[model samples]
Target: MTLKGQHLELLPVDSPEYKKHINKFKDLHLINLYKIHYTGADKNNNSDDSWSDPIYFHGTGHCGCIDRHIERRTGSVRISVSEWCQHDDGCETRGILLQGHCREHSLHEGRHYFSEDIEVALKYAADGLQEHVASDNLSNKARFSLFLCKARNIHLGHEAMHRYVVSDYDIIPCYLVIVCRQL
Candidate 1:
C-alpha cells in the first residue's frame, strides 16, 4: 500500500471515458477513504481549535472536518478543512469539495460553479505525487510520507499559481482526495 519509489503516470481527467467512470461511481454512491496531507503553513488550516494536521474522510453522509497543525522547524501554523456537502444543486458532483468559501456571500450554485480550477490543480498535484510514488524506491512508510509531501507541495503550488483568480482567498498548503468507489 505504500507508494514509495513506484512509477505512476498522471492520467488525463478530461477524457470522455474517465468522465463516464466518475459518473458511474457517483451514481452508485460509493464511499472511499483517502489520506490528504498538507503542510501547516498557516494558523487557520483546521476548523477545530486543536491545531492538528488536517485529514479528511469522503463518502456518502460524511461530514468533513478541518484540522490544523504546526511545523516544528518553521514555527509556522496552517489549517485545512473538508468540503461540505450541501443539499443545494451545487452538491451534485463535487462531493465534499474543499476550497475557500465566500464568507460574506452565500452563492448556492452548483459545485461546478465553485472552484473548478482548484480541483484541476489538485488533480495535477495528485498526479505528480502518484508519479513520484510509482518511480521512487523507498520503504512503504517512507514512500507514503513522500507521496503525501509531494501532494501537499503540488496543492500549495497550485494555490499560489492562482491566487489572483479567486476572491477572499487565504491560500493554505493542503491536499485533496477524490476516491473512486471501485478502488
Candidate 2:
C-alpha cells in the first residue's frame, strides 16, 4: 500500500492512498503516446470499425486503418496520417491543407497527454508505480514480476498518473517518456 522511493513514495492500485496519489495530476491534459490498433472481432457485426488485425505504428500522425473491408483489397490501400486534429472538422492547419497536422494538434484528447505535462508526469509513473508494486507485491511474498520493462517500465517503473483518468489498460502511457529518459 505504501511505496518508498529515493525522494517520494506512491500507492499502487488496490490501495487506499492510490487514488490520492493519482489525483496530483488529475487536471493535466492527456495526449496520445502511440497509435496502437488492436484486431479480432466477434460474429455479431462487421462494420467498418471492426478490428481486423493489429497494426502497430510508431510515432503519431499515422492512423492504423487498412483497407480490409468486404469490397476493399487486402493490403493495397492506406489512409495517410492526418496531420491536424481531424477529430470533428478541426483539421484546418496551414492554408487549406498544405502543412498538414502539426504534432501539437494531432493527439487523441481521450488517450494521450498534452505536450506540456508529459515531462512532469513520467517520474510519477516510473517511480510511483514501480515502488508501489515493489513495496506491496514484492516485499510481502512470492512475486511474479520483480521488475517492469519497456513500456511496462513507466507503469511499473513508476506510475503514469492519468491512467486513473482514462481507467483503460489498453491506452498508451505518457510517451514523452520516450524523450523523458534523456531528462
Candidate 3:
C-alpha cells in the first residue's frame, strides 16, 4: 500500500531503507517540510506588513520630533551625497553600471564635491544614519555610523539603504560601498 522513496507510509522493518531511516532518526536529523499555497495574486490573498522595516536611526539632533545631527561631527573628514537622485530609465546609474564607475565624471556625475556640497551630503548622510539607527535592524545603523566616522575621501550618502564612498586609492578612482549588508 506504500511506494518507496516518495511516500509517508510505514515501511516493513525488514527492508534495507528501514536501517537508513532508523539511522537518520538516531542521529537526530530534523527535517521540515511545508506545502506553500501561493496564488499569483499573493497580495490580494494575504496582506502583511510585519517585516517591512529593516533599520533604525538614532543619535543627536535639533529637530522637535527627531534628532537633526549636523554633517561635521568634526572638522576633518568631508561627506557628500551621490550626484544623481532619480535613478530611473537612462539615469546615471546606467553609466556606473555599464562602465563599472562612471565613464565621464568622478563617480558622482563627474562633480568633485568641495565646499558647500560636502556639507549638504554630510547632512543627508547624518539624517540617513540616524534613520538607520531608529528603524528595524541594529547592525546596519552601527555599520553606517562606523563608515561615517572613518571616511577620508568623498562621502556618498545612502541610496537604497547603503552608503558609498570614493576610495583614497589613486589607481582605482571609484566608489565603494562603505556601509551595507553583505549581499
Candidate 4:
C-alpha cells in the first residue's frame, strides 16, 4: 500500500529479514512485517539530514500517527520547557551531557520516545496492543507493535530505565512489526 508517496512492503514469512528477527520474538505470533520507505521531508523540517544511529523497538498506540508522520514528515523536540526549574532539579542540559529529563521523567508532547533494547520495546508494544484490543476490539489475542527507527540524533540518559528521547526529524520510523501473544 502507498501512503504519502511511501510504500509498505509486506514481507513474506519466509523472508530472510523475518527469519532474522522472528527468533527474538518466539513468544509472540507474527502477523506481518512491513518495510516502509519514507521519501518525504523530515518530520521536523530541519535541514540537518545526517542520521545519527539506528534505534529499534518504538511502540505507539495509534497506527494513524505513523501515516500522518509519513505524510507530513515533520516533528519537533518534546522536552520540558520550564526555564525557572521545577522538574527534578530542572531538566538536564545539552552538550557533553547526552540530554534527558530529570530522574522524574515525564512524557512531553511532540517528542518521540524509543529504546535500543528489544525487550523494552516489546513491553511497550504489548501495553499498546492491550489498549487497542480493549478499546477497538481488534483482536482477542494479546497484540503488540514495534517500529524500527532511524534516529538523526538520540538523547540517552536514564539507561536503567531504557528511555531514549529524541526530537525534531531526529527519529524516523522505517519498519513495522506486528505480533500477537502466544496462546
lDDT tens readout by residue for model 4, 1-183? 111223456666677877876775656676666665434443434245576444456764433222222222123212221211233432121100122122223244435567777767776655654543465665546445577766656665455545454443455555666666654
lDDT of 4 at 120: 76
Model with the higher lDDT, candidate 3 or 4: 4
Report residue 176 deviation for candidate 3 (angstroms): 1.6
- Whole-model Cα lDDT per candidate? 0.26, 0.23, 0.26, 0.48
**TM-score result, candidate 3:** 0.17
User: Per-residue lDDT of 79-134 in model 2, one digit per residue for the tens?
Assistant: 23232223334312111122211233433443322122333434333333343344
Writing each residue's lDDT as its tens digit, candidate 3 over 50-106 gives: 311211111111111111222123322222222112233333222322232322445
Using all chains and alpha carbons, the TM-scores for the candidates as numbered come to 0.21, 0.19, 0.17, 0.56
Worst 10 residues of 3 by lDDT: 1-10
List ranges where model 1 is wrong by over 4 Å. Answer: 1-119, 135-169, 173-178
Clashes of each: 22, 16, 16, 6
> What CA root-mean-square deviation does each model show from the true structure?
18.4, 21.2, 23.5, 12.5
Which candidate leads the pack in lDDT? 4
Question: Where does candidate 4 clash, by residue pair?
Answer: 42-73, 43-73, 43-74, 43-75, 44-74, 44-75
